[model samples]
Target chain A: MVEFKEVEGYDSLKSELKSLEKSDKPVFVLFTGSKDSSGKSWCPDCVTADPVVHASVKEKLSEGVFITCQVGPRDFWKNQSNPFRTDSKLKITAVPTLIHWGQSNRLVEEQLFKRDMVDMLFED
Target chain B: MRATLMTAMIRTGAKQCCPYAACSSSRSVAYYSKSAIDTNSNYDLVVIGGGSGGLACSKEAADQGARVAVLDWVAPTPHGQSWGLGGTCVNVGCIPKKLMHQAALVGNHLADAAAYGWQLPKDHHVPHDWNTLKNAVQDTIKASNWVYRVQLNSKKVDYFNALGSFLDSNTIKVTDKKSEKTITAKYVVLSTGLRPTYPNIPGAELGLTSDDLFSLKKSPGRTLVVGGSYVGLECAGFLKGLGLPVDLMIRSIPLRGFDQQCANLITDHMSGEGMNILWRCSPLEVVEAGNDQKKVTWLSDDGKKESQVYDTVLWAIGRQPRLQPLNLQAANVQLNQKNGKVIVDDEERSSNPSVFAIGDIAQGRPELTPVAISTGQLLARRLFAKSSRLMNYDMIPTTVFTPLEYGCVGLSEEAALKKFGEDECEVYHAFYGPYEYTIPHRSSEQCYTKIIALRDDPKTVIGIHFVGPNAGEVTQGFAAAMTCNITIDQLQSTVAIHPTSAEEIIKLRITKRSGLDPRAVGCCG
Candidate 1:
């Protein structure tokens, strides 16, 4: 079964990634917007891609670690100096970015909404 | 049955009543009939101009299962400067301007770091590198262009890197260097935005606009910025911040359409920062001098004519909608002749029922990136998803990234007084020092905040204005509060966060009408 983990903000995301670096299992990262007061992501694309990504992971390859990283509120994400954008290893430009950690495989924006693309990225 | 009737009407070239009563032209009927006949049309929506508004609308429409196509083309400036996708905000206006403004602030911080006890070499001269800063800003813009392209592709929105013009009511012709193609769509959105205009005078073409400033190959030295608009002040401010000599000439008022009190404070701050300001001066002519320099002559308010030579002359007079080449008339779209912008109703719909407008191209709306993005998204949802949410144009927040940033939302004090009448308006203001400014002995006299409220009991807040560091960040939350009709009592009752500039809003206790000094009295409130 796939093990899911959730973290908030850039500091927590960095720490989570660091802990997973030494793991033997393949790591998959989904960077999204933090929930607002209503418990829904302010980013529309993240709202659209969440259910699909979550359900697909449970149905498909279930051996790896699936991590969801909330990148904070709109103001924090809009700031160009946010480490998620400036960091060389991450360089995330938009929200709802899915990555097969340490691999060239990644999907951004509406690409995360594509079932076939999401399934392909999760393949062992 | 309707499809059959539409096909018959098209084949017979007969006039048919359109489903939308707003569409009066026979061309509209023909276009609607054609779409009905060909269910597999080229696209359901065609958005011309891939700027902030157009891109957002196109992507949202596609997400709602509409086949959308976006056409974008950047015309080179007179100085032969052009850029990739993402339009003015990314390439020239907002993104690069803010980055350079941040660079200027960092330069000031470095200078002030010495007062804060950061050890430095005695004669260390840290010269600003124009090329380095320009390259970094351009690199980010290029990355944004790639991301926008990727986003369109992933959303299944067709992207065309060509200039598009209306061929007919339903058809559009797009042309690039390599090829030309015509596309048909059921709906069209015009978000072509705006381009800077130069003053009509001798050798005016020799000067550059904001379009060329961000991507200029060399540093703009000894610059002469003509006009009193926000763009002019911002350019002059940043150039001065980077240790360059700048001369700013204003025709009349500085920052027209804004609160005069606040505008004067901004100019005062700019003058104190060592920028040369010539009020009531209008440019008469620009003559080409040797070595790529230009000689600018202007007429002072007293009718005295003066001439000076400078390495660069930038014109920030104004911008007009990019509607000349779009052939809007052919599509039956109405234009506001006074401003050259498309006349859009509250629904963002133009004269033609199937045609809509947004962004700078749309009349009577703030020319802001966030405003455009929100309007475009709301428009798409209404069109495709059957949502009836109309975009609220009121209480929209905007930031002017000057030497000391200025942010405001809702009405200005002057506007509020005029709207609510002088007897029914109350203005509360304060000037406080930021915590960081005290250590460096920086003067906080120019850091000002004001709230305009109704004079009645409870005093419902109508507007908020802020001028200081990170003014945009400070004003944003207040804008939301204004939308909620926050009252002075509610604002004052809110708990304050210590040691931050934003907390000053809640701590306001003095009214401007009291004729008392609004300056801070003690460090702790």
Candidate 2:
């Protein structure tokens, strides 16, 4: 089983990113809705994409680092000026955004559900 | 001296270390450094209220590298109903209202669809299911609440589900059912927003406000809406559209701040849609009248007394700012005596230099969601990004979600005439039918559009008003044009898209001053 590291919120993501930058391994950052006390994401899309992305990350990208960055709840994601949406390094427009760090390719929203796309994202 | 101490403490990454922690003699220093060294005061910015403005401001501030925390709590309504995060817009105000309005619109479209040659079974009787709509709306709100929580967490903005009150200029005391804690920040924003106010009449508790009406489980059968404000009109309009018998009681005129002519047209459209409007009447009392019904007694302008029984009585009188609970005196934030709203400067800074107010809580600003969001974002940018741009309160476009929607931007006709003399201004208007309405043979009597502009050379457009289908969609582009200083000639010179209600704006030639019949003659090339 592929072990995926999870970090809560933007500050933790920033700290995790800083640590990841020091490593030579390929970085895969998946921006998702933060899980509630019920252990479920508010984003239905993220809920659907989470397991598929996790399984793919574990199988194909064994050597790569998988960082699941929980973007805060619904209202925060809906905000137009959110760092997840506006940040140059990670311009996340939708939930369940999978990005191969420093790469041009990214899968957003429903694309995260496709195992082929998840594999393609991991391959790069 | 205190500033230097704070700077040194922040620079040295000192936590839980205060020189004044043991010193009880110097009260000011102890108080200041106590907050500075405390874990709660670690935040660079603390925003109160998780409404549109507060949430936006908090996220933006956090994005700009400010350690931020947001505190939000929903006080139960008089009817003992409360909602989750995302404030009034998401929970009770804009989102649910718009959805219910859309549901009512779909109801009308179904009737229109039948008229459009769509055959239905003879037994097909489509009735409005209140529970289904109520559940759907609540579901959406719940989803939004979850999203807000996730977003706040993801952005690194600490979310405190507690009611916040000022303990000092830089420190706030947050209390929930579980416990109480003190949070301190370098800067604090007050965006607590507002709540609907009820009349002080006898047995008024029997009535419901917009806050409770949206989440009510049962159908609001045979409703009576009081007040002439947009809230009352919209609730009455949607209720009537849902095929319920609705009566609206207004003390005087309708739409107090909008153009009277447009307001009259809106009321006329509502009347045409079977809304019984009682003008110049005030509610005297509401009493329970057996079997889930309430008897509403009212007095007319001429002292005529009347009573009616209704399943629901919605009070849409007006909204009051949520400042009382914040204990403004504790923070020394000045409020406008007349309106009880926080007084703010151009930068939305309150009387206390470190405190700022935005959205509906700030006096003399429009109480719209977009306005609040924009102001919040701009305020954050100015604070953390070192940008000096201020929020522009002028020419903000707003749409009333009446059955025949009304949308307007810039100055109203009365406002324009009052500002600049009648001779300096000219008004162009037209009554046109939507193509879809023609197919259904729906009366287009209330469908109209008007543009108010200066009579001088180039004739700069001052106000744009439209009363028809999709008024919001039609007025939004015109609002953008008005921002560019668009003139009557510029508006007319632009080629229009054929067979659309919005295109009627570009073809407005009959000036209201000319006394020419503004009615459309025919569909001509």
Candidate 3:
């Protein structure tokens, strides 16, 4: 079974990742737009990819940590100097960007929407 | 300071007569001192050259539990260009060339998009910024270099960023910027590949070679590419495709060793695409003409001297093995005097039995990256893994990335006919167009494919040739089939997926012996 955690900001995401740094299990981090009052993300791609990422990760990861980072409202993310955008390690250029921590595997935008792409990412 | 501390610890540990069981750190120190005490530290295998072949060999040997060391260092070109670990193919050859070729193809597609009802701005020509493409290509190369290094480290293979020269048959003196050291090995493998050769002409240094072109910061404006080697043709093709005015000056023939027909067609296609082709012309000299341009002098076939002014001059005449630096005489390694490559036996063992050579540096071996890599791995296996398999150098498929690419395996039509005699060889060919070319109306005349086979029953295919879009992709499968000794009957039985450039290969039916037009008809037939 996979352990799922949701983080609201960049600092929380970093702390979550730091806690799992020593883990032998595979760690995957997903960055997406935060949900609003209606439970829909401001970023349309994140809204479309939300179910697919959770479903695929839950099914594929037998034992690992999958962190979903909901980077605050559009105004904060839209700023060029946002930590999510400026951080060297993260370098999140787009919403709904999935990264396999400590590895180079990454999927962004519509890539997360494809079942095969998600399957390959998780399977590998 | 760290070296002094380590030496002191070793002496203290020795004086105390501490057993390895006493401490883990001391145990590791004792193991390290055993090798350090012996100045001529030995390795199971030492591979010189860090290119595709050298790296592959070192990794394979290490995987087989042999202590392997690979020494790789790149000497900068005259233009002061140097690259990291991964050799020619990754840094300057295939990777960058293919990217630039694809970039040129994308440029062409942009122009063609309007024909497919694309709402592109009217009469707006898309300009290709050379630096943008160059930087992207360099970044990709750097990433590959890092990956290769990581792979070597993970495989437990020691990599030396140093130049290796032979002290003896099994001893090598490896030198780097900081220090020099001699390492002896049970076996030494020399895979130092070839470098671009410049013609012996006055002011030759004024021209750039393939080594310099990939990393060039500025756009190669109106250019004259001298020589008809695949390198010259490919550079000419891509430069012209990239919207540069490119002139190709051929001394005698284009693609001298490849199929003459395919070579002619490739040049013809480039010529049709607005590139100037100067046949039977040899360059005399290249001199600076001021304003960041050059005045190139050439002698024509008609005993006439001609001159042209161009912003860039590139020499793609040929490549020669870089053997002088290795000091073959010191190791008693013999070379083929005609060409500077090392003379090696079937097992790639040079005159010095303790030493072996592979890749382009070995005499009569195909100078291709894949060939070098395979040979390297095989040599390692034979040396360490108790494998007796010799690297097969037959039916190796290769692709020349001209605007109209040429990919083939086995004999050329001329070679097949000459070897099998006129009556024994049969050729089936076709001129076909890809469906995608329909709307864009790209010329289909040079888009061709051919099969050379025995004239007997079953007609076992001896050669496969393709000239079209995705030639490499189309020919790779056939290369495997050729390895299986697939015949015409087998090929004809296998159905092809329609609407692909590759399908044209399977649809080949018209024989040159039949004297009928080999032009393609509708897809249904």
Best by TM-score: 1
Q: Which candidate, 1 or 2, has the higher TM-score?
A: 1
Fraction of reference contacts reproduced per prediction? 0.07, 0.00, 0.00
Candidate 3: residue pairs that collide: none
B142 Cα displacement, candidate 1 (Å): 0.4
Per-model TM values vs. the true structure? 0.80, 0.78, 0.78
DockQ of each: 0.07, 0.03, 0.04
Better of 1 and 3 by lDDT: 1
- Candidate 2 lDDT over B1-525, as tens digits, reads 335544544554232222223333454445446444655566778999999999999999888777899999999998899988789999988888889899999988888777777887666779989999998899778757766765676676888889999888888889987999887787799999999998999999999999999889899999999989999999998888888999999998999999888899999989887789999999999999999999999998789999999999999999998678788788789999988999988889877756899999998999999999999999888766666689999999999998999999999999999999899999999999888898888888989999999999889999999999999999999999999999999999999998899999989999988899999768756
What value does the lDDT take at residue B346 in candidate 2? 84
Alpha-carbon error at B319 in model 2, in Å? Answer: 0.4
Worst 10 residues of 2 chain B by lDDT: B13-22
Candidate 3, residue A11: lDDT: 97
Q: Candidate 1 lDDT, tens digit per residue, B16-43?
A: 2233464656766666566656664687
Each model's lDDT: 0.86, 0.86, 0.85
For candidate 1, the chain B TM-score comes to 0.95
Residue B357 of model 3, lDDT score? 94
